[model samples]
Target: MQLPWMSRTDRRHWKSARTTAALGELMAQWLEGSISSRPGYTPRYGPEDETRPLVPTLAALCRAGYVTTCSQPGLVGWGADDAWWEQRAAVEGVVTDPVLLHRLVDAATTAGLLVRTIDYSRNAPGEAPIPVTTRNCETAGEFGGRISEADMAAQWRGLNPDLHDEVSHGTYVIILAPEYGPTGNRLWRILAGSVQEVGHAA
Candidate 1:
């Protein structure tokens, strides 16, 4: 189903809380299947999946002729793959704080310390190419850190979230930036150390 994002014009029916909620719910379900599957998706279920977890909803959606994957293909500068259903996700949403979304997702799903990057390296008709943002980093030299350390901490307590958290779990975690080089790395590192430190302090 095509998401009627927060567009200024047009009374898009997808704006309803029900649609978004249902979609997010479906995404959660798909993630459950993806964890034991592949990095780019849950479409091709594996032995680790919950036995055709998304088949029902997906089949119904397909029968109804809803645009499932964004196969519209991204612009050249975007550097995204453009093969139908090649690089697809069950669903995607816009957010101001992608890191927070990632953490919240980790807390919401029992996928067992899961993690996934949101570069959306697919044929994104809408949410393509990802964005870049200035993150506040805490350096020993002082005058660092854009987002608060506390806010950046991982919700899942662990000795090392980056280690315990398996990226193979599924499609979760969305970094506003296109690459993990700095922002994504910082989030993972920060959350990992913060969680470890708190665990030790306790």
Candidate 2:
């Protein structure tokens, strides 16, 4: 039986789960020294003080099913169990590797887990769309001038259909832009959201 608050379609529940997971992961890292407390230390996200107690966050994580209290002294720290590790692993699995990350993104997009925008365009008068630059643009415009105007316009259209009417192009180019997390903590949140969504759906 599904709890009224546990519906898969409930955005609030999803957000809560994600936030809990992120907090758990962050606390775990802090305890493990993956993040440090030195004056010059900057966490993966930014400079932040670490002296604050994590008990409240741990309580939240416990309520969200991403953590549990352990009596073992060695395991008393923030991320001391399988639940937290599994959630962190899922997020790391998707984000650390480029290929896997793309696959995960594709899955999320297909599942409607997130909103994706694609931009596409054709090559100029003489060439096939510059596959290299086109693909680069899909990620970011690092190789600036290498991308043709048509390809850029096509890619913009593919990413945003509203732009299709604005660009009358030669070939189809597409870049998928997804609004997901880039930070480890944020990534964990996304993974937690995915897990909660799946569990609730089941």
Across 41-119, the per-residue lDDT of candidate 1 in tens digits comes to 3324432332243344332332222212211111112113332111111222222233344443453243322233333
Candidate 2 error regions (>4 Å): 1-34, 37-96, 115-202
Candidate 1: misplaced stretches above 4 Å? 1-18, 34-42, 46-92, 95-174, 177-183, 188-202
lDDT of 2 by residue, 69-90 (tens): 1101111112323221111111
Total clashes in model 1, counting residue pairs 3 or more apart in sequence or in different chains: 4
Ten contiguous residues with the weakest lDDT in model 1: 138-147
TM-score of each: 0.21, 0.19
Report lDDT (CA) for all predictions.
0.27, 0.28
Indicate the TM-score of model 1. 0.21
Name the TM-score of candidate 2. 0.19
